[model samples]
Target chain A: MIDNTLNRRQFLKSSVGVAAVAVAPGILLYGMANGSSEGASAKVRWGMLIDTSHCAEGCNDCVTACNKENGLSGGVAATDSQWIRKIEIKEIAGGRQLSLPMMCQHCENPPCVDVCPTTASFKRADGIVLVDKHRCIGCRYCMMACPYKARSFVHEALHDQNPDVPRGKGTVESCTMCVHRVDQGLQPACADACANKAILFGNLNDPDSEIAKKIRTVASVQVRADLRLNPGVRYQGL
Target chain B: MYIHSAVLFRNRLFYALVALAGIVVLAGLYSVHLMEEHGHIITGMNNQIVWGIPHVFAIFLIVAASGVLNVSSIGSVFNKHAYKARAPLAGLLSIAMLGGGLTVLMLDLGRPDRLLVAATNFNPTSVFAWNIVLYSGMFGAVAVYLWTMMEGRMKPWSKPAGFFVFIWRFILTTGTGVIFSFLVARQAYGTAILPPMFIVISFAWGLAVFHIVQSAIYAWTNKVLDDYVQKRMKNLLGVFVIAALYFVVAYHLTNLYFARQSDFERFILSDGGIYPMLLWAGYVLIGNVLPLALIYLPGFGKSYHVNLASVLIILGGFSLLYVFIIGGQAFPLSIFPGFEVKSTFGDGAISLYYPSAPEILLGLGGVAVAFLITAVGIRMLDFVPHEDTKKFH
Candidate 1:
C-alpha cells in the first residue's frame, strides 16, 4: 500500500538511494584493501640507490634474482633476453675497476617512451617505465633510442612465463623496477636478494625514506647524467 | 605475319618475366612466414645490432623512391618538355620502389601482423610516427600526381600536382633522415647535416636507378635515347654524385672535429674491419668516384660506360647504407664516457652481425615486388618515354 501509487520520480530516487548504500561500503573496502586499484599514484616516485662500494665484484645475485622474478631465460646470448646484467667498468685514466648491475634507469623523460611510435613504451605515475606489450609492434625503435641499451627485443617464443610478469616474443622489454612487487609494498627482487645490502629501493619523493635521506647526504650519480634524462636510479662510489 | 609473331613473342616474354618475379615474391613470403613462426631468433639481427642488411636494402629503396620523382618535378614543375614526356615512367618507378621498400621494412618487424595497431596508435612526438604519416601520404600524393599526368582531362592539374609532390618529397626525405638524426644516443647519427646529406644522396641514387630502368626499357623496345637527352641526363648524374660526395665528406669532417666522436670516426674511416673497406673501396671508389669518372671523363660517357656506372652506383648505394645503418650500430654506445665497460650484453665491444639466408631472401623479395610492379605497369600503361623530336633537334 505504501508504494501502490508511487510516481516515477519517487521510485527512481529510492532506487538510487538503495544502490548507493549497497555499493558504497564495498567500494571503500576494496580501495582500502587494494590501494593500487586506482592505478599508480603521482605522489610516489619509486627509485633505487646502488652503493657500489658494498657490492662484490663476482656477485651476480641481483641478476639471478631479477631473472627468476621476471621469468627470464637467464641466457646471455646476443639474442637472448637480458632484463638485467652485471657490468664491470674500469676508469680510463684512474684504472679504478667497479662492478655494478645495470638495467632500465626509469627516466622521468624516457627516450624509449618518446621514440615509441605506438605509445607502447610508457611510464607509470610512480616513475616505473613499462612496455604495454598489448600495443607493442616490436619495431625496436625504442631500443635504439635507449642510451643505456637497457631494453631487449624478445627474439624467440617464450614458454612457461610468469603469470604475474607477462612477456612474449616480438615485443621490447626491460626492467620494470620489479613493478609488481613495488605495487604490493615490497622491495625489488634485486634489492631483496643483495647479500651485502648494496641495492636500496624506496620512494624518492618521500624525504623521510632511507633512500631520500641517503641520497641527500651521499655523492651519488646517475649514469649518462649529461643526457639530462634525470633517471631515478643512482649509484654511489662509482 | 612476321610483325604479328614478333609482337606475340614480346608478349610471351613479358608474361614469363612477370611469372619469375611472382615466384620470387612467393619465396620471399615463405621466408617471412618462417621468420614469423620462429621469431627474429632465426635472423642475424640481435640486441646489439638491432638493424641489419634488410634495413640497408629497405632504406636505399625508400630514399631512391623519393629521388626518382625528381624527373617529374623537373618536367611538370619546371615545365621542361623532355622531362614531361618521361613523367609517367618516373611516377611508375617511384610507386614501384616505395612499394618494395615498405614491404621489406614491414616484413622485418617483430610483429608485422600488428600493422593495424601501428596504423591506429600513434605517438605524436616520435619521428617514426611522423614518418608513418609521411610515407603513407607519399603514396597518396604520387598516385594522384600520376593520375593527373596520365588522364587526358586531368592534364591541366598535373602542374599543381607536380608542385605539391616537389614539396612533399623534400619533407619525406627529411623524415627519412630524421629517423636517424633523432637518435641522440647513437654516435653516427645525431647531426642536422644528415637530412640534407640524405636529400643529396637520394638525388644521385634516384637518377642512377632511373637511368638503369630507362636503358632497359629502351633496349626492350628497340628505341635509342636521343644523344642530347643522354648527354644532359649523364651530366646531371655526375653533378649529383659530386654533390653527394661533398656532403659525405662534410659529414665525416664534422664528426672528426668532435672530440667525443673522433674515435667513432677513426673506427669507420680506418679501423673498423669491413666498414672502412666498404666506405673507401666500395662507396668512394666504386659508388661515387668511378661513376663520376664514367660520366665526366672524356670518352667514358658512352652508353656502355654510363650503364656500367649506373650499376656500380646502385652497388655503391648498398655499400654506403650497409656502413651507415649496420656499421653505425656496430660501434658501442659510450654509456660511461671515460670507462671501458664489459657486460654479457656486448657493452664496449663491437657487435657482430651476419645476414642469414631468410633475411637475404626477404630483402630480395622486396626488389622482386618492385620489379614485378614496374614490368606490369609499363606493359599496361603508356609509361614509355616519347621524346619531342622537334624540340630536341
Candidate 2:
C-alpha cells in the first residue's frame, strides 16, 4: 500500500520468483515420470542368469518367444537370421548333455564393438549391446570378430518387422535382451516366457537385485571366460 | 604393304581384346546389380561361411598389387639398371591391379551404397578401418611415385618416393595379415607369424604376376627379353618361391605345436576334404613343385617354361587363399572348449559353401577390370621395357 508504484528492479525480482515457484513442480514431475527419456544410465548394468538344471530339453519356449517378439522369420536356413538359438551341448570327456539357449553374451569388452569399422556396433550405457543399423555398412567384420558367433548378417530383405525393432537386409544384428521392454521396467521376452522360471533378469550392479544375490551365492560362469570378455550373461549349471 | 597390314592386324587384335574385357566387366556389373536387388542370399556366403570366392579374388588382386611394385622398388631404390627399365610397367600394373581389387571389395559389400559411411565413420580400434586408410594411401603414394619416375622434372623425388613406397607396402601387407591375426577367437588365425608369412608370400606372387605380364608384352611387340636378364629374373623368382614355401611351412609347424590349434591344423592339412585336397594337390604340387621343376630343372629353362611357372604360381596363390580364407571360416568357433555343441545355426559342425554363378562372375569382373586398365595404359604410353644391349653384354 505504501509503495503502489513499484520500481523496475523490484518488478523484475518479483517476476523471477513467481516463475520459479510455478515451474518447479512440473519440472520435478517430468523428471520423475520420464527417467529413461534422459537416455540410458551408466549406474544400471542389466544382466541375465540362466539355470540349466531347470531348463527342460526339447523345449524352445525362450527361442519361440524371442522370435515372435523380435518379428523373426523363424527359419533355420543358413541364410536365415536367428537371434536366439537352442544349442544342445555335450561334454566331450564327461558325456554330460544339456540344452541351453544361446545369444549375444553382452560382454564388457565386446569384440563386435571393437572391430566394427563404422562404430555402428555399440554398447549402451545400461550394459545393452546393439547395432545402429543406420551406420552399419554390412562389411561383416564384426561377425568375424565375435567370439561367440552371436552375430548374423541379414542375407535377404525383411518384411512385417516389429514396430519396436527396425531391421533391414545387408546389416548385421544380434540379441538385444529386449531393450525396449527393459526401458519400460519389464523383463525381457525370453525371461518372461521361460515356463520353468529358469531365466532371471535384473540389474547386476544393484546389490539387492535377485540376479546379483543369486550370482553371489551360486556357482555361475560366463561362456569362454578365458577370453577375458567378462560377459554379463551367467550360467548356473554345466 | 606387308608392314602396314601387320600393323592393322595388331590394332584389330588389340581392339578385340579390349572389347572382350569390356564385356566381362559389364557382366560383372550386372551380377552386382542382381546381388543388390536380391541380397547376399543369392551368393554362397551365409552366417557361417561369410566370405567366399569373391574374397579370394579380391585378396589376391590386393596382395599381388602391392607385390608387383617390388620391381620398381628394386630399380628405383636399389639403383638396378635392368629393373629400372621395367619400373614404368611395374608401376602401371600396380595401379591397375589395386583398382581391380578394391572394386570387387566395395561391390561385394552388403550395403555397397553405404561406402561413404565406411569412409566417414572411422573406428580407430578396427583393423578394417585401418585398411581403408592404408589402401587409399597406397593408391595416392603409388601415383606420386609413378609421376616422379615418369616426369623428367620430378625425377629427383623418385628415390624418396620409392623409399616411402617400399615401407608403405610392408605396412600395407602387415595390415592385411593383421586382419586375420587380430581374430582372437578363430582357431585358424591369431598368430604373430602370419605377417611375415604374408610378406614372403607376396614376394613370390607379385614376381610371378610381373613375369607373366612382361612376357605377354614382349610377345606382342615381337621383342626378346635378353637371355642374361631373363635368367637373373627367373633365378630371383625361384629364390622367392623357396622363401615363401619356407615361411608357409614354418607357420604350419608353429600352429602344430599349440595343443588347442591341433584340431584346426589337422582339418586343413589332412582331415578337411576339399581343403586338404586344395592345399596338397593345388598348392604344394601344382603351384610349388611343378613350377620349381620348370624353372630350375637342368633342361627346362626356356622362356615358355618360365611363363608356365608363373601361371602355376598364380594358380597356387589362389588355392592357398581358398584354404586360408574360406577354410578358416568353415571350421566352427570353439565356444565351449570341452563341449560338442549342436545348433540349427550350424554350430559344432563344418559349414558348407558352394560359390554360385553370380559370385564367380563378380570375381572374374575384377580380373577383367585390371586387364582393361593395363591394356589401356600400355597402349597410351611407352610402358614397354627396353634394356640397353651394351649394358647386358
TM-score of 2: 0.94
- The lDDT per prediction is 0.88, 0.88
What is chain B's TM-score across the candidates, in the order shown?
A: 0.98, 0.98
Model 1 error, position A20 (Å): 25
The sequence of per-residue lDDT tens digits that candidate 2 reaches over residues A1-238 is 2242133224323332333323443231112112334466565688999999988888999999999999998899999888988889999997999988889989989999988999999999878899999999888888888988898999998889999989999999999989877765567899999999989988776565688889999998999999999898999896
- What DockQ does candidate 2 have relative to the true complex? 0.65
Candidate 2, B264-331: lDDT as tens digits: 99999999999999999999998899999999999997899999999999999999999999999999
Q: TM-score of model 2's chain A, to 2 decimals? A: 0.85
How well does each candidate superpose onto the true structure, as a TM-score?
0.94, 0.94
> Over 4 Å off in model 1, which ranges?
A1-34, B1-5
Stretches of candidate 2 exceeding 4 Å from the true structure: A1-35
**Which candidate should be chosen as best, given DockQ against the real structure?**
1
Displacement of the residue B113 alpha carbon in candidate 2, Å: 0.3
**After aligning candidate 2 to the native by TM-score, how far in Å is the CA of B138 from where it should be?**
0.6
TM-score of chain A of 1: 0.85
